[model samples]
Target: MTAPAPAIPATGPTPRPPDTGARRKVGAGLLDPRQLLRALPGALRKLNPVTLARNPVMFVTEIGAALTTGLAVADPSVFGWLITGWLWLTVVFANLAEAVAESRGRAQADSLRRTRRQTTARRLTGWEPGAEPSAYLEQDVAAAELRRGDLVAVAAGELVPGDGDVIEGVAAVDESAITGESAPVIRESGGDRSAVTGGTRVLSDRVVVRITQEPGESFLDRMIALVEGAGRQKTPNELALNLLLVMMTFVFLVAVVTLQPMAVFSRDFMAAAHDTAALNADGVRGIVLVSLLVCLIPTTIGGLLSAIGIAGMDRLVQRNVLAMSGRAVEAAGDVNTLLLDKTGTITYGNRQAAGLLPVGGTDTRDLARAALLASLADETPEGRSIAAYTRREHGAGDGEPGRDVARPGMTWLPFTATTRMSGADLPGGLRLRKGAASAVAAWAVQNGGTVPAGFDYAVTEVSASGGTPLAVARQDGDGPAQVLGVVHLKDVVKPGLRERFGELRRMGIRTVMITGDNPVTAKAIAEEAGVDDFLAEATPEDKLALIRKEQAGGHLVAMTGDGTNDAPALAQADVGVAMNTGTSAAKEAGNMVDLDSDPTKIIEIVEIGKQLLITRGALTAFSIANDIAKYFAILPAMFGAVYPSLRAANVMGLHSPASAILSAVVFNAVIIVVLIPLALRGVRYRPSSADALLTRNLWIYGVGGLVLPFLAIKCIDVALVQFVPGI
Candidate 1:
């Protein structure tokens, strides 16, 4: 037999060592801090200008007050002065507080980036005789020029420079930072069996690598991008709600602007023209009425609107979920439908051969050898698994055996996206090929033969249960083909998937599997996972259309994926959740990215989202309740109806102008202070049935909403009565 050809060259540029010495140290502290501080000005400029321009109610109120201030200066009316002063104070303080809060949030984000840069990069140099060059050499170093056994220096915590066999030393590397696995993987040198992650840390070992893969295209870079880029896309629900909120604010401002003249005309004109005593009394009453109207319109709702969202986002960060958009969390809570890509997201994305079936005159050993040869040049998880299995079965030693073999050839056809098959050319015009059963079966039928009975049986059995079925066949020099056997491959499911799926079901979410795999296999896995539905042979385009169909039915869909092909569907979903193990393109198309790549993180996020919505809903009710009371407090006075009949001494003897204004402001501010902490506490959640989670959130937000307003109002009333007794 011919010796196997050298491994295919890896595509992409070699990675350059990040400068982690002098400049990096300085940049970490001084440069990072200065950049963060500088970002504040830009952030402020971006936020304040937009908020001021877009928040019509605030802008109109400020503009109206300026006009009123000018009128007061010209006419010197006490009423104009009070209106101008009160409105200006409210606008100025509210806007300033909001700006400060947002700026602080941005500063916190900057700090996180600086923390990540503190870790150092390790670079390797040197070599050995007959050994490959080290991957950690400087970018300009040519691989062909290096002699064997040269010394290579690798830095601390830097990524491994290339795919290489280790020659020396040992280290505990944190591969979990990229792998989504929580534990650090241990690496040791001097063996053909040892493998290193390109970007992982060296910890405490000095080692030399025999470069296997070329420089820049290491798995480490791909993994890092997968983890970090998961937060790029905006969900449809978020986009819609944002537009709705903006429009609602606009409507409120329009009403305020149109009604301003009526308020001005309704003022006590006669009292204004009379003596100073009457004017002072009218001014106080006018101020009270305006305050009441402003309170009625739910201005306080805006204060708590994003409070729940921000709190939820903070909680997600704590759980290692970097939610890029607050709107994504909100959308997650409302997801009635979920679509999952089979690989990586649901399956481990690593395939292993469970068993092999033989056909015609071939035995299992022959089947294994052919499979191994066909897979020798492929580097996918499936191919690797086949190669490893073949070596183990054949009792091949750890290192490559020194056996000279001739090339068996007519022509070798590599796997491609279009063909979806691979083959090796043999003497006597025999071609050994392996691929999807359907494709191979079609080829068999076209060449005037049926697939062997055992082979057909094995394909039907494995393919029906979501297992990838690979069929092997041999075609003679210009005649028909004979079927060999089938290899059944399935992704190993994560341990906790069943329980997580159960929880999701209880939450009323209908889970659906969408995969490029055959329908037979898709259905089998869907049944095993307890999915509500399955779509087999789904392309990315098909996935997007399915998501739109579900959304059109009024179901909020959460789609999870981890490849460039999945980007469009992820972007189209109501909440796009990308795995930390996904491609950079997929990550950029997702609204939220799971840093740990745990599906359970999706549950955690959903609970956080529910808490946010409940908290915001409760706060809205509480803020509005306070406004309701404010309206009632000044309603009779505004109409001049109760002022005559119900004297102040009769009712609680607390009806003075200063007393009323103080009570309203104190009540509003106090409720905000007291409820903020409670709202922030929303709920502590763990993975559980959706029903149980939702019930818990409802109980907290509901009861808190009911009790807080009563306690707040009663406390304010009693305080008012004690502090200022008679009018």
Candidate 2:
């Protein structure tokens, strides 16, 4: 190849010791006690009808608190004042639930912004490979003020100021601030790894970046906005739940308002049979009316609904995976098939020359010499690995096999998918080729060379064992070529892949492997990894076609990719998780990008998505179920004095009208505090079928929600009347 570019000194900026990997993403989740304490005042302040009106359930409580306050002030009684104060606490508790959820996203945004601070950029008038320190002027600018198309040189340990494409040089970038993984990944000019995010830190070498986006318009900025809820809109499920809550509120309002007249009718009907002589005033009926509406209207879920959605997106950010929308996170929960590539994703991707096998009269050293010459200028990973192997194993230097090593006017033929081979042509009319075994064998036989009887056997043996066989050939002038030998390229399957795929299968996701390798190699890898299926010799077009076919059948497909060829498929898939170590195009195309570059991280993502939905569904069941117990505790207490027959329905045996109402309200408020940890941490997930998970959650939240409240209300009422020395 052309002479290697001169190496430059890495003296631009020194990285902080701890900043090499992702800075620790430590922050308060919604459940932290300190976070709760900080949010209490804002939650309490939002208890007014103006702040609470959007939530129909909490707004009813506000109205009840206002009316009760007036009654407590006008005609003071221990029960009237006590009921009024508890009604106020009811509104505050609902506000606290939402505040805690918003806090998580805000905390993540703060952490991201810290990594995006303004740094000195070496401003360049024009980029040149050999530009010196004097050719570029160092200038300081705020990261937010950076404009698109600005060319800046970023050295080792410097933060990238804007999202851009690397126009020159190569370096490793630490992207942990955005993707929670701590590893520093290589970014170079040309090919897929050229794009650089604005907030990531450069760890080594210097790159001249051509800014592709303005300061606030970068991917990281948009992600920060998403986390902070600046673009917050209710999710589809949340909107549906809201509509349902409004309908439920309307039904409860009609039932509660008309019940007063029904209670009056009950009073007259039971006037002779019950203790109607002792009961007086409709004030108790009014207070109990508001309490029943607040409890029946799904208040617990409505209060924490927005927080649940925000926390899901926030959880993704904390894990170093950024989702373009909250909906994508939800879709991940429903992914049915996972299409992953064999290289880099399933295997380590470092295909190496394990051994060289000479054929016919060819010597082992001669085979290695041919491999080294063929791969001398080759840039592909497989080529570089072969060159290194020849140097280490055969003691070959940086030249052709024999003496007079440097050949004049030698040209390298790069390997292409169409040609299926690469080699060097020397000025002395010497030709060397190495690539797929089949292509090399055909060329040798075409040039009148006799093939060894074991040639086919050698190729078959290598393919069967999963080792890629690259056959080497040589030619002199216009004469026939001779087949030299075969290079055994061994690619390692990543450790623990089989177990992870098993976990995905347990989660009801079918894992499929797609690769450019032959069917024999693909089959070997598929068996070792335990994937449900595999597609061999898969081109980029094949990848796109498979995604479309799966989507046609209504399967939610998720895949990890790192190449520009993968962009279309990633865009087409339901849940496209691009590896951060992949190209910028892949990152931009996919809905989510994994910072850690771990393919199995999709499992964690799927778990987080499922947990979010489960948390919402469980709390909803709990909220509606709680209304059942509220009616039992308060309805009879409201009309029990006038209609003694209704008193039997008071299974709580509450000591007073105020105590029963107060106890139900107390349980409603405290339950929000009790489930805060569950809301933030999310419900635990079990790898069972959808039907089984639904059945289990329903029992925990549905039946338990109904049963637990009745017992809790009774206990609170007993404690209040017996220990507090009040009515």
Candidate 3:
């Protein structure tokens, strides 16, 4: 067997300059502390026991605050009250983190709402026939009141009233209001690209839109809900981590409770020597105990867990990839293999006609006649190109095929991507067929036809030159089908596909190009595009079997499709991204739709998914690690006052116990505010093998998480002692 094809060279994502030219409506001001301060009361409102009880980590702080407040009220020392007050703010800080995330989304929602004002929709009442033909008459109504299934007319410069499918006319739509891309998109009636959003504007011409969704249920509403964090739910991983933090909090509680008794026992044992370092029953202040528990738990991550998940979804929307669920987004990160087809995906979707070839010493005109008649009713670009090429080359008449040649009761076969062929039957018992070389040859032999002398040579020649060869055949009632000729279709591999396939390889994902084209054509395109594997002449069954086989090995698979035949395979894959310009069956079967209709967009979705998972993991690692330093800062200060020897755990060597606890509390609070940008933007991702990424992240986030907090806590301690009045 010949050696496998070498992989294509891959590279980075399509580079885009900062969106300053068409800036996003949301800005850095969303993170302003002054804004957070203004939203504090609302943030605090969410900290009610009923709401806080849902979070295992923050609930511990909430309970700690209640106990500490009682102790501070009873204690005579002003120092005790100061520490107690700051500890309560610690709980508020966590609430503030969640509130800030919600507030940012709300600001963007305001901007979205401004574009969604109540507009007058032109509802079609009926039409009147005149000398110019039927003219449509419409009545004006509020866009918001327009129910689903209502027909509305939108002229140029008017906003689309609701999410709907275009039923009439073609126009260029400006989607920049929602997508942030200034380029206008062309939406036409019939065939895909008909989904018009409510907030977008029709730049030119007019369209009659049949509303498919109700006003509040439109895509814009879903986007607003997404940004406002209304859809955020606790992921399984987050719930598991929260449970672990709760268990750890219990362990710390037992330790803090037992330490007081241990200290009293030490004093009893050292009574003869009169050791003043021994802790007594009262040596452990209740306020200090509350402080220690609040400090030790994973509050930073716990506070921002929902915010992180919400941010991940927001980032996806900004990229123009609409995810149906957060779970689906998470699943994208785990895909091991991607299944894509050649036409419209690896190659730019123009499959054009280069020329025609006649076989069996037949007249070229006869072959052209058969190819054109077989394809006249075929609407696919390939079929149209064949008919057009024949007309251009052989001077065929401009009459319709059914109206001119093959008359009544003739059955027409539509081209299926699975069968890779199409043909027509005549009531007079004549038949014309065209399809992939092998498929047509098989069909001919099944009907008792023998292969023509140069059939294989013709196919081999076209396939060798990277052209799709469709074999044409003709037959009568009881006679064998004879070969007529070949149709040469040429399509180019898209630019940047080489780099995208290469990037998937580096990211530890195997990309396989599956196509209905012949094996030779498949191999040629696969080699040029640089995919890891290629499946040629793949039937729908073959595509499905391939996915099941890979999944049997415990590998997660992602696939893209746009045809009715592709729906089952798409549903079978782990992450299915369908083209918005594809058939409705394809969109219904997949979990996501790419409005831009780019086939290689599967790579972008995978990257976004991976980035979301990595971002959450990194922040979680940091949140857990920072707790180690908090323990170091709080535990020693709590015990140091009674047992001077226990002060050794104070690695930072702060000014006093009061100042040390204050600094740790402040640091814990401030860190949540500090990470909001990262939560929204997500962590940076670099394409590499999984093992390499793991090692790199372990060192960067894991180790850095362990050490960064120590230094941060120490810096805050030094600064607070110099400037803050209480500390």
Candidate 4:
């Protein structure tokens, strides 16, 4: 006896218990109140102070120092020249930088909007073509009135307007866009499993869907909620880091404020002497004091921290993987496991009839004819492949030309969830049906005979190879049905899949294949595809459970699928990777969307993700290193002028106030310039080997950090000597 099937847990939230019938309401618009508050300050700062002053706080501080210096020079006119010159430079460069960054961000958003507009929605009244206001109106208006039998026209490459039943035509729809699946699904009418989603594309053929739900309440809206709702949960690491940065900034500020008074008092005392010797001494003291303040402030961090992340995001986009969140991209590099759908992802998704085995006295042709008749109205790659093979073998026309012997005089029985099989009414007593193998096998057993020996063996043999075995039979006469033959269905593996799987294994990523196909077939395909694990006969819930299990084990899981059934699991995965050619639901659910549907793209994206993380980490490390050095160099100087024994002289004229101000400005500018090249070069890089990639990053980040700061300070020293002189 077969073992009892395990109960599959629900993939998503369980239905609200009867008492809680009310639905939760959410507000519209992209930015939430808290996010807006956090972003606004940064945006304003970007526009005004930081961007405008080149270094706003520093510039203001320099102005104050210059005023004091003028007071000592006994030439108050010099204060006006210094402040005016510095202010003019800051205004020009700062505004220009802010404008350029904003423009780039706006341009990218515009391109995304353009792509969204290219798609049109179908209305119940008629076909709404183009991205005009009328099309949206038609969608909104008809969305409320749509009913069953309403033909909604979904065009090639256009998102499906609503969740509906396929009434006519066949098409490959990319549900991945919505469901986070990495493959396109071929949809047709007359199967309980066939479902069309709103915001998925009709890739090849025009399709008509019978509306199932109202437009506003459709799956697309739910998907939007899922994506939007996810933002509330902060990753542990993100929260920790944010808190750390805040604390550090606070501590740095306190140090600067506490030390500032001492430096100012020392300068005041020297000014009171009213001698040339005292003025020069004060100038030297001011330089050392200001340098100390600069060190404590961690200015280098402001230049490098976010730049690394921004550069990483740009690199991902260039590789055709649009990372919606920086955290998602970072998580992808550390992914230890991947949950993949069997049909479009692991295989080519095109089912074909491998062979047919005759049962009892049935001939091969008769078996083919039976399979074709049963599959004619069905809409699945496996069913279509069987029908096509039959037509090709018997020289029948493309259309269903012969009478359907099973269902005589049957007009229609649209496949419903209760039936599990489709049927038609013709004449006499006949019922044509095609569905799960176990169901068909049970029917044959009740008929008091077994499938012929050869046929049974063939079914078992194909199932062992991971091929779905579909039994075809017809009922003749008044009561019992005669077994005809069996059809073996198989999805062809895409080219280069084996090699890519091997590469992924080398990278220490474990691949898991999940499918609704039976265990025998699933195992066969898994072995062929080199998957580390396989879960067969899985419902949508089963797939999601597996994903959660892996994630709970501390593995960062990237899930790839292209169906409505895959959406929840995709969302649950650490990195939901949707195919560009998948349904809109999948796309919205995914963290990253690949423009190309090739599974190999996953490997490429993972590598890109790694590069991004490494680059960001390196940049952070460098920025922090510079911060440490600045603190060491300048903090002592601030205290030195206050302590008589610790007073350092400007013996080489290097520690003069003017020289210190000029050096800090030059140091900041050089660091920014140096980082620009690093960002540009890092983004353009492609690694041939993991070791080489790691080594290169280490050298750039590790060595560059140690060397660049000293060179920058030295260059500033040399330039100051050339411009200013003192004995």
Candidate 5:
């Protein structure tokens, strides 16, 4: 009787840590009142002309404010003072938006710095020829003193000293300080998960780490610098938008400058035609012209542009994604095709032996024994599961599984991409192998074995059902090699992927699965996971070629990968998100790092990226629309008394020219403060088509921008008429 299939034996390189980090909810704190207050002084400091000049529109506004303040001081009218005060407030409010964003970044940097506090490392000085932990000589040293190639031994409860690879031993590491994860992850000496970040704590066991980077060059150091905003430069889109704003400011500047002559001419004409008092009207005043100029330019968007970019990066940090540059974040927004690696991304990664099926009436016991001997020395998850499956289904006989199975003097062969198989040369010149069905069949034929009639059918049956078929074969001394049977390795598709991919589909992104599995298995998994397409039996070169091909077709690609072999393709993709558990090479190659190591995080990143662009675009539309409304408020007021017919264009009747112009200036300044929360929090982005998003933003921000300012300025005018006496 069978021994109950034995629970499938716990297998794999290492047990993946539960992703507790992604589930942790973080509050949005960029708009906290305390943060706003803390940012106020920085805003005041930014009043320096040199600092303010970076934004052309805002710089022009400051110049206008300075001009009005001086004129107000010289004349001292109630109307002049109010306009000047509001003008100055406009510049200050603009500076405040940027200050708040940078302040949050600096605060995040401070938190990271606390985690990176210097710790003592037990640096290895020497290692003896043994494999035991006690064979090494170690010395205590500061973490900063550790350099590349230096070896350090870390024990339980101690923080990892520097970014490094585990060269020996295995342990559970808590990366909560960096990844915001509370669970401990297994970091072993071999495989892609060998990389460990500095400042994370070791939870259990001990590992000998080889530092990969010098001081101030580790991943955490880079992350700290990024969050500090010291390395932030405007993205290409931001630069292009700034150029557009500068041109718009220039156009408005020219319109404002020439308005003086027009005002003088209108004053002269009105005085000659009707009354002499028209010559002395406030319309010709330079301060009045300056107020109009300030309100006409696109100050609203110019003020919040930097804030939008900084907050976008800050949002990414909050989501446990560290983008190396603003460009990568922006590119993520435009990804047309997402090339996902099938193993870790689309599926649960590890393939396990589900069963063994014998062909051509072969005895099940004979096939089980051959499979066990072939997989005994294999370290892959499938190999270990196979041996465990055999021991439970068959029997250990006189010895334990994987221990003293047959005889001595055996030579082991490990799996490689080229060979596509792993096996051993047993005692008495018997060779046993287990690997890809095609690979083993070819080897058996090469070794003069007669092909089993039902071999092809068994392999196809397993593969068509989304199972990898590993064929077992044997060659006895001086005799023909014969096929034993096929081992079924089952792959499980990750949960909720179909729904997530459907969301991406709605967002106009195509999801492609790339894997080394056979075509049948690839098709089955791809359909089950709901990917748009699949490329089976792909090599590393095939992945790179596919990225290039997609780019050639004018598609922007985003891909996630963790293996060192995935580095080149990751580098080639437009947005490459490397898992934090990936190798250092893969991490360095990719543009962004997912601290939570969730492949589906690219979906959130795409949303954040799109939101960044949407926020800037929506605000820009509102700002321009705002300027259009201001033209109606201030233009007709400036020229109304000089030309009576101009009063007809003043849609909102005002008590005086003073009230109308001042109301426009006040509305302009107050609106910047009004939208500060929106600028920091960003506009809500749902996955939809480009045209749909455009139409919605146009109706909301664009149409609303035009209508709201008219009512707001009119109300401010009515309030001004109640109190002020100058008019």
Candidate 6:
């Protein structure tokens, strides 16, 4: 088997200068002092009952805290004051968890904002459509003044004023501000690489940009809003979990409310029987219903639920991906089928000119000149490679060795989907073209040129070897166009893809590669990349149909695309991750945007999503099991006075009833704060069978949760006896 090639950017390369900076780091530490300090104010503000009401569990805790505070003040006992203070602290700690998560995201947003400074745009005037002008009138204007459809000229070293498509010329753009990649990437007038972000800088040449976004509606604005938690909403799973918690809280509230009447009835019966030794009636009087209610509800999970959701989005942003909603991130965890583009996902995407094969009686040098001249004005990576190959093998004529300069009076013909060719119309009635073999052969036939012998062999050989063949041809005045040779463009499969696909397969995800390449080439590339399936000659309609078919079979489909034509299929997929550099239509249609524009980043997305789901699941198990142990610690203390034998239920023998009650509530509140870091960091994940994962969660969180709280509550009671007099 052929070894895979080293990976490059999905967008092809341009002429690069020396590196200016290293990759930008994403997100600060979860326990960063600065982030914690920033969160404190927000936490304090969230204490308002209106804001706390959004979380039913937390709201109930706050109400209980308020009731306890009133009772503590009226009765004025040491134990009452201690319990009231800890109850209020519990509400504050829950608010602090959510606040800390939001603060981390806010920090990321602030950093992004720094890169988007206001700049002036050289807006063009007197530029009529379809009119040929040597130059357009330039008007100095603020970038904010430029509206959609307005054209602006951005020169080298100038930041792109807004989100736009390149309408003319080609340039090397540095997108380090948003993508965190230091290498420069090419942005040309047409194709998938044409879309440029507002804050990226043009490092070389100039481009005529047609602004695509209005003020405050650019890609950067959307990204900032997402990272700052301004656009966060609960996912379907989160809503359902909250509903379950609310129901549990309601049941526990009723149970606690009925406990007081039962205590009164038990006391009356013992008094009538004159069994004074069996009952401590004073202990029944001391049972605090509010404390029992707070301890019983699922407070640990409720306190950290919002924090967990916020941290999930923050994790995606840290990975240089922006999700439009929490639902998209959650969906990524359950993606069963991943529909990937062949060019960038499996292969390096840069189809380079590897060789030249002459046809008929054409000389090697003659074919080289035609190919180089045809590619001189082409800015695509393949075009640049063709020109570079010609210059290196055959000497440059009257031009610099590394540079490509067009002759005077030459008209550059750019490649289009309809024409399927790019070339130059030279001086003195000479026309040169190079593109797909079929397109060039048809063009030659239309111009009265006969098909050259052995031309089919050359095209066949390139295609059979997983390479694209571009036929170079020329026409002079009224003379027929004759085919000269074939330019061999080979796209290499990316390295380590087989291994990555294997991992996905283990996780039960089916990988599919879709491309416009013919069957032989597609088959070879798919096998090389170890994908499960391949679809050759796939059009936008074909892609949409495939996604619909997968969904019909009850599969959750995920796909990555970066073109206007891909918008339909992207919108149809269960999880659509659009490249940040793609057209506005594609970006708007997808639910997530990959900042690095790496098609294979979806694999990483899947892992993050799984980690998020696993984290929530694990913490929930721990929270529910924790209540079991709290029951053992608090229940016996509440009723031991009513029945002497009930003291046996105090498995972790405590000094007194007051200490046990105080310890249980204290442990309940402190655990939320203790688990905040774990909630933010998320649970570690590995690709394994569902049964294995379920078994592991049961043992680690479920069993540990049931045991740890008993010891913690007992230790707290022992310490409370030493410090506090009443308890």
User: What is the C-alpha local distance difference test score of each model?
Assistant: 0.56, 0.76, 0.74, 0.55, 0.83, 0.82
lDDT at position 159, candidate 3? 88
lDDT of 6 by residue, 392-433 (tens): 766423342112334556677766778888887877898888
Clashes of 2: 1
Model 2, range 618-654, lDDT digits (tens) per residue?
Answer: 8888888987888888767666766678889888787
Of 5 and 6, the candidate ahead on TM-score is: 5
TM-scores for the candidates: 0.54, 0.79, 0.71, 0.58, 0.79, 0.79
Q: What local lDDT does model 4 show for residue 376?
A: 57
The deviation in Å at residue 149 for candidate 2 is: 3.6
Q: Which residue window of length 10 is worst by lDDT in model 4?
A: 19-28
Clashes of each: 32, 1, 2, 37, 0, 0
Supply the TM-score for candidate 5: 0.79
Between candidates 1 and 4, the one scoring higher on TM-score is 4
lDDT of 4 by residue, 33-147 (tens): 3432333344445544444344433343344345445543553232123323433333233223223323333444444333232234465454443334454433433444555
Which model, 3 or 4, shows the larger lDDT?
3
Candidate achieving the largest TM-score: 5
- Candidate 5: Cα lDDT at 493: 75
lDDT by residue (91-209, candidate 1, tens digit) is 55334333333333444454433323322223344444444554235333433333333334454555554444455666665655444455765555543124553445566666655
Q: Model 6 compared with the native: what TM-score?
A: 0.79
* Model 2 worst lDDT window (10 residues): 12-21
- Whichever of 3 and 6 has more lDDT, that candidate is 6
Worst 10 residues of 3 by lDDT: 3-12
For model 5, what is the C-alpha lDDT against the true structure?
0.83
- What value does the lDDT take at residue 14 in candidate 3? 26
RMSD of each: 13.8, 7.3, 10.8, 12.8, 7.1, 8.0
Superposition error at 162 for model 1 (Å): 17
